[model samples]
Target: MPVLILGLVLFLGVHSLRIFADGWRSRQRARLGELRWKGLYALVSLVGFALICWGFGLARQHAVLLYVPPLALRHANALFTLIAFVLVAAAYVPRNHLKAAFGHPMLLGVMVWAFGHLLATGMLHDVLLFGAFLLWAVALFVASRRRDRREGTRYPAGTLRGSALTLVIGVVAWAVFARWLHLWLIGMSPMG
Candidate 1:
Protein backbone atom coordinates (compact mmCIF):
# COMPACT_ATOMS: atom_id res chain seq x y z
CA MET A 1 0.00 0.00 0.00
CA PRO A 2 2.80 2.41 0.80
CA VAL A 3 4.58 1.64 -2.46
CA LEU A 4 1.32 1.90 -4.34
CA ILE A 5 0.58 5.26 -2.76
CA LEU A 6 4.07 6.53 -3.52
CA GLY A 7 3.87 5.31 -7.11
CA LEU A 8 0.51 6.93 -7.62
CA VAL A 9 1.75 10.19 -6.20
CA LEU A 10 4.83 10.18 -8.40
CA PHE A 11 3.05 9.08 -11.56
CA LEU A 12 -0.07 11.18 -11.18
CA GLY A 13 1.87 14.16 -9.89
CA VAL A 14 4.09 14.18 -13.01
CA HIS A 15 1.06 13.75 -15.26
CA SER A 16 -0.80 16.54 -13.53
CA LEU A 17 1.94 19.06 -14.16
CA ARG A 18 0.73 19.97 -17.63
CA ILE A 19 -2.85 20.11 -16.47
CA PHE A 20 -2.16 22.17 -13.36
CA ALA A 21 1.15 23.87 -13.90
CA ASP A 22 1.30 24.60 -17.56
CA GLY A 23 3.54 27.61 -17.13
CA TRP A 24 6.01 25.71 -15.02
CA ARG A 25 5.99 22.81 -17.45
CA SER A 26 6.63 25.17 -20.32
CA ARG A 27 9.46 26.77 -18.48
CA GLN A 28 11.03 23.42 -17.72
CA ARG A 29 10.57 22.30 -21.30
CA ALA A 30 12.20 25.45 -22.51
CA ARG A 31 15.05 25.08 -20.09
CA LEU A 32 15.65 21.37 -20.66
CA GLY A 33 14.85 21.34 -24.38
CA GLU A 34 12.01 19.25 -25.73
CA LEU A 35 13.84 16.00 -26.46
CA ARG A 36 15.71 15.88 -23.15
CA TRP A 37 12.60 16.84 -21.21
CA LYS A 38 10.50 14.22 -22.97
CA GLY A 39 13.18 11.59 -22.41
CA LEU A 40 13.33 12.33 -18.71
CA TYR A 41 9.56 12.43 -18.42
CA ALA A 42 9.16 9.13 -20.20
CA LEU A 43 11.82 7.51 -18.03
CA VAL A 44 10.15 8.70 -14.88
CA SER A 45 6.73 7.65 -16.10
CA LEU A 46 8.01 4.18 -16.95
CA VAL A 47 9.63 3.78 -13.54
CA GLY A 48 6.51 5.01 -11.84
CA PHE A 49 4.35 2.63 -13.86
CA ALA A 50 6.60 -0.28 -12.90
CA LEU A 51 6.34 0.66 -9.26
CA ILE A 52 2.58 0.95 -9.52
CA CYS A 53 2.23 -2.51 -11.03
CA TRP A 54 4.53 -4.07 -8.48
CA GLY A 55 2.91 -2.30 -5.57
CA PHE A 56 -0.60 -3.09 -6.76
CA GLY A 57 0.35 -6.73 -7.04
CA LEU A 58 1.77 -6.79 -3.52
CA ALA A 59 -1.20 -4.92 -2.13
CA ARG A 60 -3.69 -7.26 -3.81
CA GLN A 61 -2.14 -10.20 -1.94
CA HIS A 62 -3.50 -8.84 1.33
CA ALA A 63 -7.09 -9.02 0.01
CA VAL A 64 -8.76 -6.40 2.16
CA LEU A 65 -12.41 -6.92 1.22
CA LEU A 66 -14.78 -4.05 0.80
CA TYR A 67 -18.46 -4.42 -0.22
CA VAL A 68 -18.93 -7.38 -2.52
CA PRO A 69 -20.22 -6.19 -5.84
CA PRO A 70 -23.25 -7.91 -7.28
CA LEU A 71 -22.79 -10.37 -10.12
CA ALA A 72 -24.80 -8.06 -12.34
CA LEU A 73 -22.21 -5.34 -11.88
CA ARG A 74 -19.53 -7.63 -13.27
CA HIS A 75 -21.60 -8.06 -16.40
CA ALA A 76 -22.09 -4.33 -16.60
CA ASN A 77 -18.35 -3.89 -16.20
CA ALA A 78 -17.75 -6.10 -19.22
CA LEU A 79 -20.10 -3.99 -21.31
CA PHE A 80 -18.57 -0.77 -20.05
CA THR A 81 -15.07 -2.04 -20.80
CA LEU A 82 -16.06 -2.69 -24.40
CA ILE A 83 -17.21 0.88 -24.80
CA ALA A 84 -14.15 2.12 -22.98
CA PHE A 85 -11.90 0.31 -25.43
CA VAL A 86 -13.75 1.92 -28.32
CA LEU A 87 -13.19 5.33 -26.83
CA VAL A 88 -9.52 4.51 -26.31
CA ALA A 89 -9.18 3.45 -29.92
CA ALA A 90 -10.86 6.66 -30.98
CA ALA A 91 -8.08 8.55 -29.24
CA TYR A 92 -5.54 7.06 -31.62
CA VAL A 93 -7.50 6.68 -34.83
CA PRO A 94 -7.78 9.90 -36.72
CA ARG A 95 -10.85 12.00 -37.30
CA ASN A 96 -13.29 9.69 -35.53
CA HIS A 97 -16.59 11.11 -34.44
CA LEU A 98 -16.04 9.62 -31.00
CA LYS A 99 -12.92 11.72 -30.62
CA ALA A 100 -14.64 14.76 -32.03
CA ALA A 101 -17.62 14.30 -29.77
CA PHE A 102 -15.66 13.61 -26.60
CA GLY A 103 -12.74 15.95 -27.42
CA HIS A 104 -10.67 13.86 -25.05
CA PRO A 105 -11.40 10.23 -25.75
CA MET A 106 -8.43 8.83 -23.81
CA LEU A 107 -9.36 10.54 -20.60
CA LEU A 108 -13.01 9.63 -21.06
CA GLY A 109 -12.00 6.04 -21.72
CA VAL A 110 -9.98 5.99 -18.50
CA MET A 111 -13.04 7.21 -16.62
CA VAL A 112 -15.15 4.43 -18.08
CA TRP A 113 -12.49 1.79 -17.54
CA ALA A 114 -11.84 2.82 -13.95
CA PHE A 115 -15.54 3.14 -13.18
CA GLY A 116 -16.20 -0.29 -14.63
CA HIS A 117 -13.45 -1.84 -12.54
CA LEU A 118 -14.66 -0.04 -9.43
CA LEU A 119 -18.12 -1.48 -9.98
CA ALA A 120 -16.81 -4.99 -10.51
CA THR A 121 -14.14 -5.23 -7.80
CA GLY A 122 -14.47 -4.63 -4.07
CA MET A 123 -11.15 -4.62 -2.23
CA LEU A 124 -8.79 -2.07 -0.80
CA HIS A 125 -6.22 -2.37 -3.57
CA ASP A 126 -8.93 -2.34 -6.21
CA VAL A 127 -10.45 0.77 -4.72
CA LEU A 128 -7.14 2.53 -4.46
CA LEU A 129 -6.03 1.78 -7.99
CA PHE A 130 -9.33 2.32 -9.79
CA GLY A 131 -10.45 5.23 -7.64
CA ALA A 132 -7.21 7.08 -8.10
CA PHE A 133 -7.30 6.55 -11.85
CA LEU A 134 -10.95 7.66 -11.99
CA LEU A 135 -10.20 10.85 -10.11
CA TRP A 136 -7.16 11.58 -12.28
CA ALA A 137 -9.08 10.90 -15.45
CA VAL A 138 -11.90 13.19 -14.42
CA ALA A 139 -9.45 15.93 -13.56
CA LEU A 140 -7.49 15.47 -16.79
CA PHE A 141 -10.65 15.46 -18.91
CA VAL A 142 -11.92 18.66 -17.34
CA ALA A 143 -8.55 20.37 -17.59
CA SER A 144 -7.95 19.31 -21.18
CA ARG A 145 -11.39 20.45 -22.25
CA ARG A 146 -10.78 23.78 -20.61
CA ARG A 147 -7.45 24.09 -22.40
CA ASP A 148 -9.06 23.15 -25.70
CA ARG A 149 -11.76 25.73 -25.18
CA ARG A 150 -9.15 28.36 -24.46
CA GLU A 151 -7.31 27.42 -27.64
CA GLY A 152 -10.49 27.27 -29.72
CA THR A 153 -9.67 23.75 -30.78
CA ARG A 154 -11.93 22.08 -33.31
CA TYR A 155 -11.88 18.43 -34.25
CA PRO A 156 -12.53 17.45 -37.83
CA ALA A 157 -15.93 16.08 -38.80
CA GLY A 158 -15.65 12.30 -39.00
CA THR A 159 -17.23 9.95 -41.50
CA LEU A 160 -19.24 6.87 -40.70
CA ARG A 161 -16.35 4.70 -41.85
CA GLY A 162 -14.08 6.12 -39.19
CA SER A 163 -16.64 5.36 -36.53
CA ALA A 164 -17.04 1.81 -37.80
CA LEU A 165 -13.30 1.27 -37.83
CA THR A 166 -12.97 2.55 -34.30
CA LEU A 167 -15.71 0.22 -33.09
CA VAL A 168 -14.29 -2.80 -34.90
CA ILE A 169 -10.77 -2.23 -33.67
CA GLY A 170 -11.90 -1.60 -30.12
CA VAL A 171 -14.06 -4.71 -30.03
CA VAL A 172 -11.30 -6.83 -31.47
CA ALA A 173 -8.82 -5.51 -28.95
CA TRP A 174 -11.28 -6.05 -26.13
CA ALA A 175 -11.91 -9.60 -27.26
CA VAL A 176 -8.20 -10.35 -27.31
CA PHE A 177 -7.68 -8.88 -23.87
CA ALA A 178 -10.76 -10.46 -22.34
CA ARG A 179 -9.97 -13.84 -23.80
CA TRP A 180 -6.24 -14.16 -23.29
CA LEU A 181 -4.13 -11.10 -22.45
CA HIS A 182 -5.96 -10.34 -19.23
CA LEU A 183 -5.38 -13.84 -17.99
CA TRP A 184 -1.79 -14.02 -19.17
CA LEU A 185 -0.79 -10.62 -17.89
CA ILE A 186 -2.98 -10.03 -14.87
CA GLY A 187 -3.51 -13.69 -13.86
CA MET A 188 -7.29 -13.24 -13.93
CA SER A 189 -9.63 -13.10 -16.83
CA PRO A 190 -12.16 -10.31 -16.81
CA MET A 191 -14.47 -12.48 -18.85
CA GLY A 192 -14.22 -15.28 -16.32
Candidate 2:
Protein backbone atom coordinates (compact mmCIF):
# COMPACT_ATOMS: atom_id res chain seq x y z
CA MET A 1 0.00 0.00 0.00
CA PRO A 2 2.83 2.38 0.81
CA VAL A 3 4.45 1.61 -2.51
CA LEU A 4 1.21 2.19 -4.32
CA ILE A 5 0.69 5.50 -2.57
CA LEU A 6 4.25 6.55 -3.32
CA GLY A 7 3.87 5.53 -6.94
CA LEU A 8 0.68 7.50 -7.34
CA VAL A 9 2.30 10.54 -5.79
CA LEU A 10 5.28 10.31 -8.07
CA PHE A 11 3.36 9.64 -11.24
CA LEU A 12 0.41 11.95 -10.68
CA GLY A 13 2.52 14.67 -9.14
CA VAL A 14 4.74 14.81 -12.19
CA HIS A 15 1.72 14.86 -14.43
CA SER A 16 0.15 17.71 -12.49
CA LEU A 17 3.03 20.10 -13.04
CA ARG A 18 1.47 21.62 -16.14
CA ILE A 19 -1.78 22.05 -14.26
CA PHE A 20 -0.21 23.75 -11.23
CA ALA A 21 3.16 25.10 -12.28
CA ASP A 22 3.43 25.64 -16.01
CA GLY A 23 6.21 28.21 -15.69
CA TRP A 24 8.36 25.97 -13.53
CA ARG A 25 7.86 23.11 -15.95
CA SER A 26 8.81 25.32 -18.84
CA ARG A 27 11.98 26.46 -17.09
CA GLN A 28 13.01 22.89 -16.40
CA ARG A 29 12.33 21.87 -19.96
CA ALA A 30 14.34 24.80 -21.22
CA ARG A 31 17.26 23.99 -18.94
CA LEU A 32 17.32 20.26 -19.55
CA GLY A 33 16.47 20.26 -23.26
CA GLU A 34 13.42 18.42 -24.59
CA LEU A 35 15.03 14.99 -25.03
CA ARG A 36 16.63 14.94 -21.61
CA TRP A 37 13.46 16.17 -19.98
CA LYS A 38 11.45 13.52 -21.78
CA GLY A 39 13.96 10.82 -20.85
CA LEU A 40 13.80 11.75 -17.18
CA TYR A 41 10.05 11.98 -17.30
CA ALA A 42 9.76 8.56 -18.92
CA LEU A 43 12.11 6.99 -16.40
CA VAL A 44 10.21 8.36 -13.44
CA SER A 45 6.87 7.40 -14.97
CA LEU A 46 8.08 3.84 -15.60
CA VAL A 47 9.42 3.40 -12.08
CA GLY A 48 6.22 4.78 -10.61
CA PHE A 49 4.10 2.56 -12.83
CA ALA A 50 6.06 -0.52 -11.82
CA LEU A 51 5.66 0.31 -8.14
CA ILE A 52 1.94 0.91 -8.60
CA CYS A 53 1.45 -2.48 -10.26
CA TRP A 54 3.56 -4.26 -7.66
CA GLY A 55 1.83 -2.63 -4.74
CA PHE A 56 -1.59 -3.17 -6.24
CA GLY A 57 -0.82 -6.87 -6.64
CA LEU A 58 0.39 -7.11 -3.08
CA ALA A 59 -2.61 -5.25 -1.73
CA ARG A 60 -5.02 -7.40 -3.72
CA GLN A 61 -3.43 -10.54 -2.32
CA HIS A 62 -4.43 -9.41 1.17
CA ALA A 63 -7.97 -8.71 -0.09
CA VAL A 64 -9.17 -5.94 2.20
CA LEU A 65 -12.86 -5.81 1.40
CA LEU A 66 -14.92 -2.66 1.58
CA TYR A 67 -18.60 -2.48 0.66
CA VAL A 68 -19.57 -5.10 -1.82
CA PRO A 69 -20.91 -3.54 -4.99
CA PRO A 70 -24.08 -4.79 -6.66
CA LEU A 71 -23.54 -7.17 -9.56
CA ALA A 72 -25.45 -4.79 -11.84
CA LEU A 73 -22.79 -2.14 -11.29
CA ARG A 74 -20.33 -4.41 -13.04
CA HIS A 75 -22.46 -4.20 -16.18
CA ALA A 76 -22.62 -0.44 -15.78
CA ASN A 77 -18.86 -0.40 -15.51
CA ALA A 78 -18.59 -2.21 -18.85
CA LEU A 79 -20.81 0.38 -20.49
CA PHE A 80 -18.85 3.23 -18.96
CA THR A 81 -15.59 1.68 -20.11
CA LEU A 82 -16.89 1.51 -23.66
CA ILE A 83 -17.51 5.24 -23.62
CA ALA A 84 -14.17 5.84 -21.92
CA PHE A 85 -12.31 4.01 -24.68
CA VAL A 86 -14.07 6.05 -27.32
CA LEU A 87 -13.10 9.26 -25.57
CA VAL A 88 -9.53 8.06 -25.33
CA ALA A 89 -9.50 7.25 -29.03
CA ALA A 90 -10.79 10.72 -29.75
CA ALA A 91 -7.67 12.19 -28.15
CA TYR A 92 -5.44 10.58 -30.78
CA VAL A 93 -7.61 10.69 -33.85
CA PRO A 94 -7.62 14.04 -35.55
CA ARG A 95 -10.88 15.87 -36.28
CA ASN A 96 -12.96 13.68 -34.00
CA HIS A 97 -16.17 15.17 -32.66
CA LEU A 98 -15.48 14.17 -29.11
CA LYS A 99 -12.12 15.92 -29.13
CA ALA A 100 -13.55 18.99 -30.79
CA ALA A 101 -16.25 19.29 -28.16
CA PHE A 102 -14.34 18.27 -25.07
CA GLY A 103 -11.02 19.94 -26.01
CA HIS A 104 -9.35 17.45 -23.69
CA PRO A 105 -10.69 14.03 -24.51
CA MET A 106 -7.87 12.20 -22.73
CA LEU A 107 -8.71 13.75 -19.37
CA LEU A 108 -12.39 13.07 -19.94
CA GLY A 109 -11.51 9.50 -20.76
CA VAL A 110 -9.54 9.18 -17.55
CA MET A 111 -12.48 10.49 -15.59
CA VAL A 112 -14.77 7.96 -17.19
CA TRP A 113 -12.34 5.10 -16.69
CA ALA A 114 -11.72 5.97 -13.05
CA PHE A 115 -15.39 6.48 -12.36
CA GLY A 116 -16.25 3.15 -13.94
CA HIS A 117 -13.72 1.29 -11.85
CA LEU A 118 -14.87 3.07 -8.72
CA LEU A 119 -18.43 1.88 -9.33
CA ALA A 120 -17.44 -1.72 -9.91
CA THR A 121 -14.75 -2.24 -7.25
CA GLY A 122 -15.21 -2.13 -3.50
CA MET A 123 -11.82 -2.42 -1.93
CA LEU A 124 -9.58 -0.05 -0.01
CA HIS A 125 -6.79 -0.07 -2.57
CA ASP A 126 -9.19 0.20 -5.44
CA VAL A 127 -10.88 3.24 -3.94
CA LEU A 128 -7.57 4.89 -3.17
CA LEU A 129 -6.29 4.30 -6.68
CA PHE A 130 -9.37 5.07 -8.71
CA GLY A 131 -10.47 7.94 -6.50
CA ALA A 132 -7.14 9.62 -6.85
CA PHE A 133 -7.32 9.30 -10.62
CA LEU A 134 -10.85 10.66 -10.64
CA LEU A 135 -9.78 13.72 -8.69
CA TRP A 136 -6.69 14.20 -10.77
CA ALA A 137 -8.60 13.89 -14.02
CA VAL A 138 -11.12 16.47 -12.89
CA ALA A 139 -8.38 18.88 -11.97
CA LEU A 140 -6.57 18.22 -15.22
CA PHE A 141 -9.68 18.77 -17.24
CA VAL A 142 -10.31 22.13 -15.61
CA ALA A 143 -6.70 23.19 -15.96
CA SER A 144 -6.43 22.14 -19.60
CA ARG A 145 -9.58 23.94 -20.59
CA ARG A 146 -8.36 27.03 -18.82
CA ARG A 147 -5.08 26.82 -20.61
CA ASP A 148 -6.80 26.38 -23.93
CA ARG A 149 -8.93 29.44 -23.30
CA ARG A 150 -5.90 31.49 -22.34
CA GLU A 151 -4.08 30.40 -25.46
CA GLY A 152 -7.11 30.95 -27.66
CA THR A 153 -6.95 27.38 -28.87
CA ARG A 154 -9.39 26.34 -31.52
CA TYR A 155 -10.00 22.73 -32.48
CA PRO A 156 -10.89 21.88 -36.05
CA ALA A 157 -14.48 21.07 -36.83
CA GLY A 158 -14.90 17.29 -36.98
CA THR A 159 -16.30 15.15 -39.78
CA LEU A 160 -18.65 12.23 -39.44
CA ARG A 161 -16.12 9.92 -41.05
CA GLY A 162 -13.48 10.63 -38.41
CA SER A 163 -16.02 10.11 -35.65
CA ALA A 164 -17.10 6.85 -37.18
CA LEU A 165 -13.49 5.69 -37.46
CA THR A 166 -12.80 6.61 -33.84
CA LEU A 167 -15.90 4.74 -32.78
CA VAL A 168 -14.91 1.67 -34.74
CA ILE A 169 -11.38 1.65 -33.35
CA GLY A 170 -12.54 2.17 -29.79
CA VAL A 171 -15.10 -0.62 -30.01
CA VAL A 172 -12.60 -3.04 -31.50
CA ALA A 173 -10.03 -2.18 -28.87
CA TRP A 174 -12.56 -2.46 -26.06
CA ALA A 175 -13.83 -5.77 -27.39
CA VAL A 176 -10.30 -7.18 -27.52
CA PHE A 177 -9.57 -6.02 -24.00
CA ALA A 178 -12.87 -7.22 -22.61
CA ARG A 179 -12.63 -10.60 -24.29
CA TRP A 180 -9.01 -11.47 -23.59
CA LEU A 181 -6.47 -8.81 -22.64
CA HIS A 182 -8.34 -7.52 -19.64
CA LEU A 183 -8.54 -10.97 -18.09
CA TRP A 184 -5.03 -11.90 -19.09
CA LEU A 185 -3.32 -8.75 -17.85
CA ILE A 186 -5.55 -7.37 -15.11
CA GLY A 187 -6.89 -10.68 -13.79
CA MET A 188 -10.46 -9.54 -14.43
CA SER A 189 -12.76 -9.68 -17.43
CA PRO A 190 -14.82 -6.62 -18.29
CA MET A 191 -17.48 -8.67 -20.07
CA GLY A 192 -17.73 -11.21 -17.33
Candidate 3:
Protein backbone atom coordinates (compact mmCIF):
# COMPACT_ATOMS: atom_id res chain seq x y z
CA MET A 1 0.00 0.00 0.00
CA PRO A 2 2.84 2.41 0.79
CA VAL A 3 4.56 1.56 -2.48
CA LEU A 4 1.30 2.01 -4.37
CA ILE A 5 0.80 5.39 -2.73
CA LEU A 6 4.34 6.43 -3.59
CA GLY A 7 3.90 5.38 -7.22
CA LEU A 8 0.67 7.35 -7.55
CA VAL A 9 2.32 10.41 -6.01
CA LEU A 10 5.26 10.27 -8.38
CA PHE A 11 3.14 9.68 -11.49
CA LEU A 12 0.26 12.02 -10.70
CA GLY A 13 2.47 14.70 -9.18
CA VAL A 14 4.67 14.93 -12.26
CA HIS A 15 1.59 14.95 -14.48
CA SER A 16 0.06 17.80 -12.48
CA LEU A 17 2.98 20.20 -13.07
CA ARG A 18 1.43 21.63 -16.23
CA ILE A 19 -1.84 22.27 -14.42
CA PHE A 20 -0.34 23.59 -11.19
CA ALA A 21 2.95 25.17 -12.26
CA ASP A 22 2.79 25.95 -15.95
CA GLY A 23 5.44 28.65 -15.64
CA TRP A 24 7.82 26.36 -13.75
CA ARG A 25 7.25 23.58 -16.28
CA SER A 26 7.91 25.96 -19.15
CA ARG A 27 11.10 27.14 -17.51
CA GLN A 28 12.31 23.60 -16.95
CA ARG A 29 11.51 22.62 -20.51
CA ALA A 30 13.46 25.59 -21.79
CA ARG A 31 16.37 25.09 -19.40
CA LEU A 32 16.74 21.39 -20.05
CA GLY A 33 15.95 21.53 -23.77
CA GLU A 34 13.24 19.41 -25.43
CA LEU A 35 15.06 16.09 -25.88
CA ARG A 36 16.62 16.01 -22.42
CA TRP A 37 13.40 17.11 -20.74
CA LYS A 38 11.44 14.41 -22.53
CA GLY A 39 14.03 11.79 -21.64
CA LEU A 40 13.87 12.75 -17.99
CA TYR A 41 10.10 12.80 -18.04
CA ALA A 42 9.96 9.36 -19.67
CA LEU A 43 12.37 7.94 -17.12
CA VAL A 44 10.30 9.15 -14.18
CA SER A 45 7.06 8.00 -15.77
CA LEU A 46 8.50 4.54 -16.47
CA VAL A 47 9.80 4.07 -12.97
CA GLY A 48 6.51 5.22 -11.48
CA PHE A 49 4.56 2.90 -13.78
CA ALA A 50 6.73 -0.07 -12.87
CA LEU A 51 6.24 0.66 -9.20
CA ILE A 52 2.49 0.93 -9.70
CA CYS A 53 2.34 -2.48 -11.36
CA TRP A 54 4.51 -4.13 -8.74
CA GLY A 55 2.76 -2.50 -5.81
CA PHE A 56 -0.71 -3.16 -7.15
CA GLY A 57 0.16 -6.83 -7.53
CA LEU A 58 1.47 -6.99 -3.99
CA ALA A 59 -1.50 -5.12 -2.53
CA ARG A 60 -4.10 -7.22 -4.32
CA GLN A 61 -2.75 -10.36 -2.68
CA HIS A 62 -4.09 -9.23 0.70
CA ALA A 63 -7.64 -8.73 -0.76
CA VAL A 64 -9.27 -6.19 1.53
CA LEU A 65 -12.79 -6.10 0.15
CA LEU A 66 -14.94 -3.03 0.62
CA TYR A 67 -18.57 -3.04 -0.59
CA VAL A 68 -19.15 -5.52 -3.34
CA PRO A 69 -21.11 -3.98 -6.19
CA PRO A 70 -24.07 -5.71 -7.74
CA LEU A 71 -23.40 -7.88 -10.76
CA ALA A 72 -25.35 -5.40 -12.88
CA LEU A 73 -22.81 -2.67 -12.12
CA ARG A 74 -20.03 -4.97 -13.16
CA HIS A 75 -21.76 -5.48 -16.48
CA ALA A 76 -22.28 -1.75 -16.79
CA ASN A 77 -18.56 -1.27 -16.40
CA ALA A 78 -18.05 -2.94 -19.76
CA LEU A 79 -20.10 -0.25 -21.43
CA PHE A 80 -18.34 2.48 -19.49
CA THR A 81 -14.95 1.12 -20.44
CA LEU A 82 -15.96 0.90 -24.09
CA ILE A 83 -16.95 4.55 -24.12
CA ALA A 84 -13.76 5.42 -22.28
CA PHE A 85 -11.73 3.69 -24.96
CA VAL A 86 -13.57 5.61 -27.68
CA LEU A 87 -12.88 8.91 -25.97
CA VAL A 88 -9.21 7.94 -25.65
CA ALA A 89 -9.13 7.09 -29.33
CA ALA A 90 -10.58 10.49 -30.11
CA ALA A 91 -7.56 12.09 -28.48
CA TYR A 92 -5.24 10.43 -31.01
CA VAL A 93 -7.50 10.55 -34.04
CA PRO A 94 -7.59 13.86 -35.88
CA ARG A 95 -10.83 15.78 -36.51
CA ASN A 96 -12.96 13.78 -34.08
CA HIS A 97 -16.09 15.33 -32.62
CA LEU A 98 -15.32 14.02 -29.11
CA LYS A 99 -11.99 15.86 -29.13
CA ALA A 100 -13.47 18.99 -30.68
CA ALA A 101 -16.24 19.18 -28.14
CA PHE A 102 -14.42 17.96 -25.00
CA GLY A 103 -11.04 19.57 -25.85
CA HIS A 104 -9.43 16.85 -23.71
CA PRO A 105 -10.98 13.51 -24.43
CA MET A 106 -8.10 11.55 -22.95
CA LEU A 107 -8.60 13.10 -19.51
CA LEU A 108 -12.33 12.50 -19.80
CA GLY A 109 -11.59 8.91 -20.73
CA VAL A 110 -9.36 8.46 -17.70
CA MET A 111 -12.05 9.83 -15.42
CA VAL A 112 -14.65 7.53 -16.92
CA TRP A 113 -12.38 4.54 -16.69
CA ALA A 114 -11.58 5.22 -13.05
CA PHE A 115 -15.18 5.89 -12.14
CA GLY A 116 -16.39 2.67 -13.75
CA HIS A 117 -13.74 0.63 -12.04
CA LEU A 118 -14.55 2.25 -8.70
CA LEU A 119 -18.19 1.30 -9.10
CA ALA A 120 -17.41 -2.28 -10.05
CA THR A 121 -14.56 -3.19 -7.73
CA GLY A 122 -14.69 -2.83 -3.92
CA MET A 123 -11.21 -3.76 -2.81
CA LEU A 124 -9.21 -1.21 -0.81
CA HIS A 125 -6.36 -1.22 -3.34
CA ASP A 126 -8.84 -0.91 -6.21
CA VAL A 127 -10.44 2.12 -4.59
CA LEU A 128 -7.08 3.71 -3.89
CA LEU A 129 -5.87 3.20 -7.42
CA PHE A 130 -9.01 4.14 -9.36
CA GLY A 131 -10.09 6.89 -6.97
CA ALA A 132 -6.72 8.58 -7.23
CA PHE A 133 -6.93 8.50 -11.01
CA LEU A 134 -10.51 9.77 -10.94
CA LEU A 135 -9.63 12.72 -8.74
CA TRP A 136 -6.49 13.55 -10.70
CA ALA A 137 -8.25 13.32 -14.04
CA VAL A 138 -11.08 15.56 -12.87
CA ALA A 139 -8.64 18.16 -11.62
CA LEU A 140 -6.46 18.03 -14.71
CA PHE A 141 -9.41 18.13 -17.07
CA VAL A 142 -10.90 21.17 -15.38
CA ALA A 143 -7.52 22.91 -15.32
CA SER A 144 -6.87 22.09 -18.97
CA ARG A 145 -10.27 23.38 -20.03
CA ARG A 146 -9.73 26.63 -18.13
CA ARG A 147 -6.33 27.05 -19.75
CA ASP A 148 -7.81 26.41 -23.18
CA ARG A 149 -10.51 28.98 -22.55
CA ARG A 150 -7.94 31.55 -21.38
CA GLU A 151 -5.89 30.97 -24.51
CA GLY A 152 -8.97 30.89 -26.77
CA THR A 153 -7.90 27.54 -28.14
CA ARG A 154 -10.13 26.03 -30.81
CA TYR A 155 -10.00 22.38 -31.89
CA PRO A 156 -10.24 21.36 -35.52
CA ALA A 157 -13.72 20.54 -36.76
CA GLY A 158 -14.52 16.85 -37.01
CA THR A 159 -14.76 15.05 -40.34
CA LEU A 160 -17.17 12.19 -40.77
CA ARG A 161 -14.52 9.84 -42.08
CA GLY A 162 -12.06 10.56 -39.30
CA SER A 163 -14.73 10.22 -36.63
CA ALA A 164 -15.88 6.93 -38.08
CA LEU A 165 -12.33 5.62 -38.14
CA THR A 166 -11.82 6.68 -34.56
CA LEU A 167 -14.96 4.81 -33.50
CA VAL A 168 -13.89 1.66 -35.34
CA ILE A 169 -10.42 1.69 -33.90
CA GLY A 170 -11.70 2.32 -30.41
CA VAL A 171 -14.22 -0.55 -30.53
CA VAL A 172 -11.72 -3.02 -31.93
CA ALA A 173 -9.09 -2.06 -29.42
CA TRP A 174 -11.56 -2.24 -26.57
CA ALA A 175 -12.80 -5.63 -27.67
CA VAL A 176 -9.30 -7.00 -27.89
CA PHE A 177 -8.28 -5.61 -24.52
CA ALA A 178 -11.48 -6.57 -22.72
CA ARG A 179 -11.60 -9.99 -24.24
CA TRP A 180 -7.96 -11.07 -24.13
CA LEU A 181 -5.36 -8.58 -22.95
CA HIS A 182 -7.16 -7.77 -19.70
CA LEU A 183 -7.16 -11.42 -18.69
CA TRP A 184 -3.58 -12.02 -19.76
CA LEU A 185 -2.05 -8.96 -18.19
CA ILE A 186 -4.22 -8.38 -15.14
CA GLY A 187 -5.16 -12.02 -14.48
CA MET A 188 -8.83 -11.05 -14.46
CA SER A 189 -11.45 -11.37 -17.18
CA PRO A 190 -13.52 -8.22 -17.54
CA MET A 191 -16.07 -10.01 -19.72
CA GLY A 192 -16.39 -12.88 -17.32
In candidate 1, residue 127 scores what lDDT? 97
Sorted on TM-score, best first, the list reads 3, 1, 2
Q: Rate the local accuracy (lDDT) of all candidates.
A: 0.92, 0.91, 0.94
Model 3 residue-pair collision total: 0
Backbone steric clashes in candidate 2, count: 0
lDDT of 3: 0.94
Off by over 4 Å in 3: none
Comparing candidate 1 with candidate 3, which one achieves the higher lDDT? 3
Lowest lDDT 10-mer window, candidate 3?
A: 45-54
Q: lDDT tens digits, residues 90-150, model 2? A: 9999998998898999899899999999999999999999999999999999989998999
- Model 1 C-alpha RMSD vs. true structure (Å) is 0.8
- Give the distance in Å from residue 40's predicted Cα in candidate 1 to where it truly belongs: 0.8
Index of the highest-lDDT prediction: 3
Q: Please identify which of the two predictions, 2 or 3, would achieve the higher TM-score against the true structure.
A: 3
Reference-based lDDT, residue 190, model 3: 99
Please report the TM-score between candidate 3 and the true structure: 0.98
